[model samples]
Target: MSPGTNVVIALAISSIVIVVISFRNKLVYRQRRELHGCEVPPSLPQLDPVFGLDLILSRFTSLKADRRNVSLLEQFRRHGNTFQSITFGRTTFFTIEPRNLQSVLSTDFLSWGVEPMRLFAFEPFIGKGIMCSDGAFWEHSRALIKPTFARTQIADLHLDDFGVHVERLIDLIPKDGSTFDLQPLFARLALDSSTEFLFGESVQTLAPDLTPSSAESFLEAYDYGQSCVGRRIQLPKFNFLTTDSRFWKSCQTAHEFVDQQIQKALLVTSKQKQDVDGRSRYILAQELLRQTHNLLDIRHQLLNIFLPAHEAIGVAMTNIFFNLARHPRIYTKLRNEILVADLKARTLTFERLKSLKYLQFVINETFRLNPTIGTNTRMALKDTILPTGGGPSGHGTSPILVRKGDSVVFGFYGLHRMPNVFGDDVDVFRPERWEKLRPAHWSYLPFGGGFRVCPGQQLALTEIGYCLVRMVQAFERVENRDPTMEFVEHYKITTESKNGAKVAMVPSHL
Candidate 1:
C-alpha cells in the first residue's frame, strides 16, 4: 500500500479504539450504579453534579475551618439520612440512618474494610495493630488479645489499681475555691492506672514527688506522636517528601521508650514465669509476648492499647466530669445513688459496681451526649448496598449503591442526639432518657458495633465507673468553675476538649 493509504488506515483504527474505550467506561459506570441492590445514594440536598460539588465545598470548608464535622446533618434532615458528598471529584458519604449503620457495621460488615486513610495515618505511630488494621491482621490481633480482657482479669485490674489513681485524682484537685483543669489530671490518673494494668507497674504519672514529672517522660513523647499522626493525615500525600522533623523526633522518642520497656519485659519474662499453675496467666504484655515473639508486633499492640486506654479514658472522664459539673442536680443524684449502693452492698464487686442503675445511666448519658470515639469510618471493599436510606433519589427502600472506593462516616454526635431516635429531649443532658427508652440497634454504639467492636470496652467502662464511684465518695459537690465552657472537641483518633475540662471539686462536708 502507499504511505497515504497507510496513514488513513491508522486514523481509522485510532478512532475505533477511542470509541470502544468510551463505550466501556459508560458500561462500567452503569454496572456500578446497579450494584448492591441499587444505584449510589443521591448527593446531599438531592442535587445534580455541579450543585453537589458546591454543597460538598460548603461542608468541606466548615470541616477545614475545624467547625462541626456533621455539617450535613441539616441536609440529612431536609433531604434524607444517607447522602453523598464529592471532594476532588471523589465521592464520600454519611449514613446516620439506623438500618444503614447496622448494615455497614454489622450485617454486611465483610463487604467493607477499614478506611485506608486511617491505616496510612495511624500505622506510623502505632504500626499494624488492631485499631487501624483490617482483614487477616486484624483478626489475628483481635483473637490473640481477646482473652486478656476476661471478666475476672479486668475486675481485678479495677479493684487493685483504678481506685488508687482515683484517690490521687481527688487529692490533686484544688480546694482553695480556685479552679483547675481536669483533663491533664484525668490523663495522669488514666495513664497511671492503665500502665499498672498493662505492665504490672503504674507509671505513677500522678505521683506527688516525681522529680522530672510524668509530662517530661515517655508519656509526653507518646502524646506528641499520637497527635502527630492526626497532623500527618491532614497534610498532603507524599508529605514525607518534606516530612516534619519534629514528628519524626517524637516518633523516635516514643518508640525508643516503648522498645526499652519491651526489651526489659522480655528479659524478665524469659527468666521468670510467674505462673502458679502450668496453664499460664493473662497479663497484657507478658501474655501477648508469650504468644508472639515479634517485638514490633508487641510494641504496636502495646501502643494501640496504651494510647487509647489512656487518651480515650482520660478524655471520656474529663468530658463526663465537665458535664456533671454543669449539672449539679445530676451530680447530686449520682452521688446519692453511689452512697446508696455502697451502703446496701456487703462488698463492692464488679457486678455490684455495674449494677448501680442510676450511676450507669449517668455514664450512658455522658457517652450519648459526647462520645470520645466521635465517629467511625469504613471504606467499601466492593460494590455494596446498605439495608436502608434509599429514598433520596425517589428510590425508597431500593438500597443505596456504594461504589468500591467510597467511604462512609458514622457521626455519633447527630446519631445519638437525633430527636427521632432519642425523643424530643435528645439535645438535653438527661440520664433518665435511658431509664425508659431502649435504644434501637445501631443507635447506641458508644463502644462501636459488630465483630470489630472494641474488645476493651468492658475494661474501659469499668475504669470509668470505678473512678466515678470513688470521685462521688470523695467529694460532696462537683461544679464547673468555668460556666462559659462549651463543647468544642479537638480530634485525633479520639476527640478531647481544646483547652481542658475546668471544674471545681469540693470535699465532703461531713
Candidate 2:
C-alpha cells in the first residue's frame, strides 16, 4: 500500500479505539449509577446549552436590576433543592439541601477541591492564601494562621483595643436624629479595626485628620480591588474578560500597602524589638512572620484574613443596623436587654458578650437574611454522590451523580430561608425566632463549616457584638429613613444593602 493509504488506515483504527473507549466508559458509569441509585438532577432551562450565554446574560441582567437574590431564590423554588445547568459546556450543580451541603462540605470533603476557584479567580487578586488554596497548601495556611485567632489572642485584643474604634464610630453618629447612611461609616470602622488587628496599626479611616495619604490610597485601592475581585469571582471562568489595567493597578496599590506593613514587621523582628516570646501583643502579620519570612506568603495570608475580617464585620454591622432601623420594636427589645444586663458595670469580655442571648439572636437573624458570603462554589475533584438532590421530581431525596470537574454552587442565602427549617415567616426579620429555632447542622453557616470553617468566627462575632452593644447603648431607638422598608442587595464577595441603611437615631440621654 502507498504511504497515504497506510496513514488513513492508522487514523481509522485510532477513531475506532476512541469510540469504543467512550462507549465503555458510559456503560461503566451507567452501571455504577444503577448500583448506587444515583439519578441526574433536574436541568435548568437554558436557551443555549453549548455556551450557556443565555444563562449568563440573564444573571447579569438580574444583577443589574438588583434582584440577584430574588432571581436565585426563584430558581430553587422552580427547580427544587437541587438542579443542574450548563455553563460554558460544563455541567454545574446547584443545591440548597442541608444534607447535600453536609456531604459536600464534610462527609465527602476529599472528593471536592477549590482549585478552580483559586486558579480561575482569587490567585490573581489575593494570591495563594488559606482561603484560596486547597489540599496540603490550605492545611499549612490554616495551621500557620489559626493560632492568631486563639481564644487568648482574641480576648486580649478585645475590650481595650476594640473600645477605641467603637468610640470613634459612635462619635460620628449624628446627635440630632438626622437621617444618615451608616454603611459607609461601618466600612471605615471595619477597615480601621481590621488594620489594627492584622498589622498592629490602624488605618484610622474614621479619623480623617490622622489618616495619611498612603493610608487613604491604600483604602481606595483596596476597596476598588475587592470590588473587582467580586466581579471576577462572579464570572470566574471569564475573569480575563473582566480584569483590566485599572484592576491590576488597584491590586498593585493594595499589594504595596501590605508590603510596607510586612517590611515594618520584618524590621521589628530583625531588631528583636517585638517581644515574640512573651506573647504580650498579637499581630496577624507578626504571627505570620514567625512562621515564614517569605514576603509574598506573609502578604497573601494577611490579605486573605484581612479581606474577610474587613468585609464580613463591616457588612454584618451594616445589615444589623439595617434591620434594627426598620424593626424599632426589636431594636428597643435588644437595647432593653443590653441595659438590663448592666454590661457597662462589668467588663465585656468575650465570654460575657457570648452570654447576651438576645444580642446573639439579633446577629444570627441578620446573618440568616444576609450572610456575608452569600453563595459559594466548589469543584469536584473526583466522581462522587451527593447525599440527596436527585430523582424525577428533584425533591432532593435521592442521591445525585456528580462527575469529576463539575462545579457545585451552594447558596447560603436560600439555605437560610428554607421554610421548613426557618418557618413560613422566613422573610420576616424576627430575632425572637432564634429563641427556639434549632436548624439542622450545616443548615446555618454564617461563617461556613467543616475543615475550612472560618478561623475568625470568634473575633468576628466579638467585634460585631461589641459594636452592636455600644450603638444600642448610645442610641435609644433606631428609625428607618429610607422610603422603602425592604432590604435590597448590594452583593459582592459579601452582600449588603443596595440602598444604604439610611436611619436616624434617638440619643439615649434625650
Candidate 3:
C-alpha cells in the first residue's frame, strides 16, 4: 500500500479504538441497570451539558452571593430528594434521601471512597491522615485515634481545666452589656481547649496576657491555612492556579507549631519513660506518639484531628448562640432548666450535660438548621446501586445505578430540612420540635453516619454543652444586637454565621 493509504488506515483504527473505549463503561452500566431494574435520576438542565460550564459558573456565582448551601437546597427542592448533575464534566449524584445516604455511608460504605478532590485540597495543610486519606490508611488512622476518645477519656471532661478557659471567655465579654461578636470568642475558646486537650498545653488565644508572639502567629497561620484550604476544596483540580505563597507560609507556620508541640510531648515522654495510656489521659499528641514516634506523621495526625474539632466546636457554638440571641423565650426556658437543675460548673460531667434535655434540644435544632459541615461528597469506588432516586419520574422509589468514579454529594442541610422528616416548618428554629421528633435514619447526621462518623462527636457536644451552660449561668439574658435577625452563612472549612453571633448579655449579678 502507498504511504497515504497506510496513514488513512491508521487513522481509521484509532477512531474505532476511541469509540469502543468510550462506550465500554456505558455498555456495562446499561447492562447493570437492566439486570438490577435501575434507572437514571433526573439530570439538572444545563446549557453546557458536556462540560457543565453553566453549572460551574452558577456555583461560583452562588458562592460569591454567600448562598452556596441555599443554592444547593433550592436545587433539591426543584429536582426532588435525589437528582443527578454534571459538575465540571464529572457525573455527580446529589441526594438528600436517607435510604441513599445509608447505603453510601454505611451498608455499602466500602464501595465509596473519600472524594479525591477533598484529599487534594486538604493534604497541603493537613497532610495524609484520617481526614484526607482512604482505604487502609484511613482505617489505620481511625484505629489509631479511636482509643484517644474512648468512653473513659471522653467522659472525663476535666471540668476544672476547661472551666479556666470558660472563665477567660466570660471575662472578655463587656460588663456594661455592650454588643459583641461571639464568633471569634468561640473560635478562640475551642482552639485553646482543643490544644490543651490534644497537645498537653493550650495556645491560650483567649488569654491575651498569657499568649506569646509564637502562639499568636500559630493561631493566625492556622486560621489563614484553614481559609485557603476551604477555597481549595471547592476547585481542587485547579488549585494550582489559585494557591499562593501566603498559603504555603501559613501551612509552614501551622506545621511548625504542631511540630514544636510534638517535640515537647516526646521530650516529656522520654523523661518520664513510662508507657502512657492515652485513653486514660485523653491527650491526642501523647496518644499519637504511642502509635508512632515519627515526628512528621504525628504532626499530620494532630493537625488533621485539630481541624475538625476546632471548626466543629467553634462553629456549632456560634450558631447555637446566634439562635439563642434571637429567640429570647427559648433562652429563658433553657436558663430555667439549668437553674432548676441547680447544676454547677464543678458538677458538669458528661452524663449530667447529656441529661439536660432542653439543652440537647436546642443543640439539636441549631445543628439541624446549620450543620457545621453542610455538604459532603464521596466517590464511588465500584459500580453499585443506591436504594432510591430512580425510575421515569426521577423521584420514583427505585434503585439508581452509580457507576465507579462518579461523585455522590449528600447535603445534611437539605436532609435536615426535609418537610416529611423535619415537618413543614423546616426553616423555623424550633427546639420544641425535638421533644417528639424522630427523624428517619441517616436523615439527621449533624456529626455524619456510619463507620466514618466523627469520633470527636461526644467531645464536641460535651464542650459545646459545657461552655453553653457556663454562659447561660453567667448571664441573666442574651439579647440580639445585630439588626439582621437572619443567619447568613460564612463558609470556611466549616460554616458559621456571616454576620456572626452579635449580641449583648445582661450579667446575672447586674
Quick one: best lDDT, which candidate? 3
lDDT of 3 by residue, 275-371 (tens): 2333234577887887887878888888889998888778998999999999999999999999999987878988889999999999999999999
lDDT tens per residue, model 2, 1-510 = 999999999999999999999899779888988999989889988889978999999988988887777788899988898899998767898899888888888989999888666655667667888877888988888888998786565654445667788888898889898999999889888888888878877878777368688877887887777767777776847656454888888888888999998887776644222433444657778878888878898988988888898887888999999888888899989989999988772367678888999999999999998888778888998998888988767685779877788889999989999999999999899999998998877899999888788888888888888889988998998899999888888766677788888999889983
Off by over 4 Å in 1: 1-23, 31-40, 45-66, 70-72, 151-153, 211-215, 234-236, 240-242, 269-282, 343-346, 393-396
- Which clashing pairs does model 2 show? none
Residue pairs in steric clash, candidate 1?
none
Worst 10 residues of 3 by lDDT: 271-280
TM-score of each: 0.88, 0.93, 0.95
List, residue by residue over 137-169, the lDDT tens digit for candidate 1: 888888778888754555543555566677777
Clashes of each: 0, 0, 0
Candidate 2 backbone clash number: 0
Question: How accurate locally, in lDDT, is each candidate?
Answer: 0.73, 0.83, 0.85
Poorest stretch of ten by lDDT in candidate 2: 270-279
RMSD of 1: 4.1
Clashing pairs in 3: none
What would the TM-score be for candidate 1 when compared with the true structure? Answer: 0.88
Off by over 4 Å in 2: 1-24, 236-243, 269-279
